[model samples]
Target: MTDLIKIMQQRQSCRSFSEKPVEAEKIVSCINAACLAPSACNTQPYHFYIAHAPEAVAVAAEYCKGEKVNKWVGEAKAFVLITQEHAEIPAANSEARKRDYRQYDIGLMIENFCLEATELGLGTCILGVFNEEKLKANFRIPSPKSIALVIAIGYPADSEIRKKHRKPLEEMITYLR
Candidate 1:
């Protein structure tokens, strides 16, 4: 199998992380990969902020709503906040279509970052249940965009916990003429 396929198969949402800190250069590489993701009309409106401070991670953990997430997020060595700006859509465009495409663009960027992190032997989890308003206030995100997602990064604590099960390809695939 190709390296990309191997990376995809091995990638999993890691909740337990070791105390080892991720290298700054590695994090930057992941973010660079994310920035190269394709976007609708090439309007890459996403912005990313990386927080490596322990105090900042603690603050973000407090604002996270998930109990399981709070336990793990608090220990993460770094946090990445992804945001997207609100753009005006042409009157001729369908609202649903515009929304769908923008969301797709965001998903692509997130996946790229995740895969890059995996390649770097780092663990990451995409978090959605965060207090957006509080994060903006605490993180001082300037106006023009809103949080899309947050990713917690660190080294996996245990290999067993890193193993992830996936649905069978046959079950997920739909063959159509």
Candidate 2:
């Protein structure tokens, strides 16, 4: 199998991490991959705030909903807070289109980021359960738009977790007559 295929297969949500720090270059590479993701009309409205500092991570932990899960997030060596600027979309676009487009674009960017991190032998988990208001206030996010997601990144701890099974192609695919 190709390296890409292997990376995809091996990718999993890692909740535990070692105390070791992830290199700056690797984080930049992951962000670069995110930037390369396809966006609606090339708007590229996403902005990422990397929180590797102990203080910032602590703030993130406070906003996180799950105690055990977020404690692990706090311990993570690195995290990226993905936010989108709603005003970045042109006024000419419909409100519905703008709302939907921003989310779709951010999701694409996150997937690209995770894939790149996996390829670099890093472990990551996309975290959604967080206090948005607190995060925005703590992070000084100027925009009134939604803070889409937060991804925790670090080296995985030793453990035996089973791979999540996926539906077979035969069950998911359909041929049009």
Candidate 3:
């Protein structure tokens, strides 16, 4: 397997984090990696609002709560609100295949960020159970737009990357001849 494949297999959603702040330079580098991910016509329509300040991180964490599984997000030292803009590919490109392009683009950018963070020895968890409406209001975000994902990142305070249980290739794949 390739280095990227190894990285992908190693990445895990970290639930416990330490008080140690993620170095600013490393955070910037990871975000840069995300920006380099492919998008529709290179539209790069995703926006990442990073919250490193204690107060800001607190606010972001608040909106990420409301569920038992995500309560740990509050303890994270850094939070990123991943916002995706509505897709507006050029009119001439209207023939493009249908699907929510913005959502797909966001997924690529987020995986890039997580892979970079893992390579940097930082831990991350992609959070989706947050209250999007409240989160938007807290950030003064207008309604009707998409907030694709919220990610928690920091130094790990808990266990190492444990074994992941997954289906084997045969069960999940089909070889078409």
Instruction: Point to the candidate with the largest TM-score.
Output: 3
Score candidate 2 by lDDT.
0.81
RMSD of each predicted structure: 2.8, 2.8, 1.7
Model 1 TM-score (2 dp)? 0.84
lDDT per residue for candidate 3 within 10-32, as digits (tens), equals 78999889888888788888899
For each candidate, what is the lDDT? 0.81, 0.81, 0.85
Task: Rank all candidate structures by their lDDT, best first, as comma-separated numbers.
Answer: 3, 1, 2
Model 2: how far residue 105 lies from native, Å: 1.3
Where is model 2 poorest over a 10-residue stretch in terms of lDDT?
87-96
Residue 144 deviation, candidate 2, in Å? 0.5
Which candidate, 1 or 2, has the higher lDDT? 1
RMSD of 3: 1.7
Off by over 4 Å in 1: 65-69, 87-100, 161-163
Judging by lDDT against the true structure, name the best candidate: 3
Per-residue lDDT of model 1, residues 23-81, tens digit only: 98888999999989988766676778888777887777767647554565776788898
- Predict model 1's lDDT versus the native: 0.81
Tens digit per residue, CA lDDT, model 2, 1-177: 997777777778888888778997899999999999988767887888888777887787678747545656765778788888643556676664535577788889888899998888788999988888988888888757677898888888864445779998899999999
